[model samples]
Target: MDYRMFKHRMVNIVERMKAIGGNVSEVMIGAPASLQQIEACEIKLGFQIPESFKKVLLEFSSSCNLRWVFPDEYQLAGELDGIFSGMLHWDLALLKELNDDKNGWVKEVFSNPDDEYDKVWHQTLAFYEVGNGDYIAFDLVDNSTDACVIYLSHDDGEGHGYKLADNFIDFLEKWARIAFVGGEDWQWLLFTSNAQSGLLPDSQSAKLFRSLLKLSI
Candidate 1:
C-alpha cells in the first residue's frame, strides 16, 4: 500500500479500536524519520529495510498500545508473557544499539561466545521487543525486499522462530481485521466483552482478548 492508503487504513483501525472502548490513547502516532536515519540503520544492519516496514517507522514508529497476555495454558508456565504484544516501531538508535550490543538479550539467544553479532543476527532485524527476551522481527534470510515477520522467542531457544506474517503490511492488515472485525468465535467474545464493560473490561475478559490476539503474532 502507498503511504496515503496506509495512513488512511491505520486511522480507520484506530477508530475501530477506540469504539471498542479499549485504552488506545497511548497508541501514539510517531513522527517520520529522516532519510539519513533510515540510511544509517540500513548501513549498520547490512540489509535494506522492507519498504512497508520503513513506511511505518517513517510515519509512526509505534502505532498501538498493547500488552502481552498469555494464554490460560501458559499462565502457570509463565513462558509466553513476552511472545508478542502491541505493534510498536523501534527507534533507529535503539535498533542499531540492540543489533550491535554483544551483551544484550539478543546475545543470550546466540550465546555462543564465538558468534559475532552480525553472524548471529544477520538474517533477523529485531524492531519490537516483547520484553523479557522476545522480539517481533523481520526475517531477512530470504533477502526479500519485503521480509516475513517472525516472532523470536528467547525462552523457546534458538532456531525456533515462529512465522507470523508474509510481510509487515500483511501483519498489520491481519491485526486490524482481527482486532476490529472479529473473525473467530473468541474474537467476537472479546469485542462483546469490551463493549459491555466500557473499554476497561474485567481482568479475565481483557486477558482473554490479549491472549487471543497474541495467537495472531
Candidate 2:
C-alpha cells in the first residue's frame, strides 16, 4: 500500500483501539521520525525494515517519542507494548548491545526454525517488544513485498511464535477486530489464524468486549 493508505489504516486502528480502552497513560504513539533517522536506525539494526512498516512510522511516529494522535497505544500487551516505538532506538550502537548473542538475546527469537526465521535468525529484527521479553516483529530476510509479521518469545525457545499475518496491516486489522487483546495474550495460542477470546469465542475480556461493544464475534 501507499504511504497515504498506510497512514489512514493506522489512524483508524489507533482510534478503534483507544475507543476500546481508555487507558491513555498506557498507549504512546509518537511523532514522525525523519527519513535520515529511519535510515540510520536500519543501518544500526543491520537490516532493512519493511516499507509497509516504515511508511507507517515515517508518516506517523518519531524514533522514540509518542505519536499522541493514533496507534500510540496498540502496545496492548504487558503495560501496552509499544510497536515502532520499541522497534527503533535513537542510539545506533545500542542495537548490537541489546540483541547481541552474548546476552543470550536471540536475534532469531521465534521457535519454528524452518518456518519463522528460515534459518537466517540474525536477519530478523524485532520492532515491537513486549515488556516481558516477547516481541511482535518482522523478518528482514523476507523477499515478499510486505514482510511477514511474526511473534517472538524471550523465554520460550521451542514455541516462541509463528507467522501470524502476511503483512503488518493485516496483523493490525486482526488485532483491532479483537479489541486489541493484551499483547502475547494467552488467547493468541488458541488461534491457528484468527484470534478469539472466551471459550465460546475467546477469553472473558473478549466476552466483555462483545457485551459492551456489541462485536459480532
Worst 10 residues of 1 by lDDT: 180-189
What is the lDDT of every predicted structure here? 0.51, 0.48
- Name the regions of candidate 2 deviating beyond 4 angstroms: 1-26, 63-103, 107-122, 157-159, 191-217
lDDT of 2 at 116: 38
Task: Give one digit per residue, the lDDT tens place, for model 2 in 138-158.
Answer: 655645655877666565533
**Residue 60 lDDT in candidate 2:** 57
lDDT of 1 by residue, 27-65 (tens): 445566877888888898777888778877676553333
The TM-score, computed over Cα atoms with residue i paired to residue i, of candidate 1 is 0.56
Best by TM-score: 2
lDDT, residue 137, model 2 = 63
Task: Report how far residue 138 has shifted in candidate 1, in Å.
Answer: 1.0
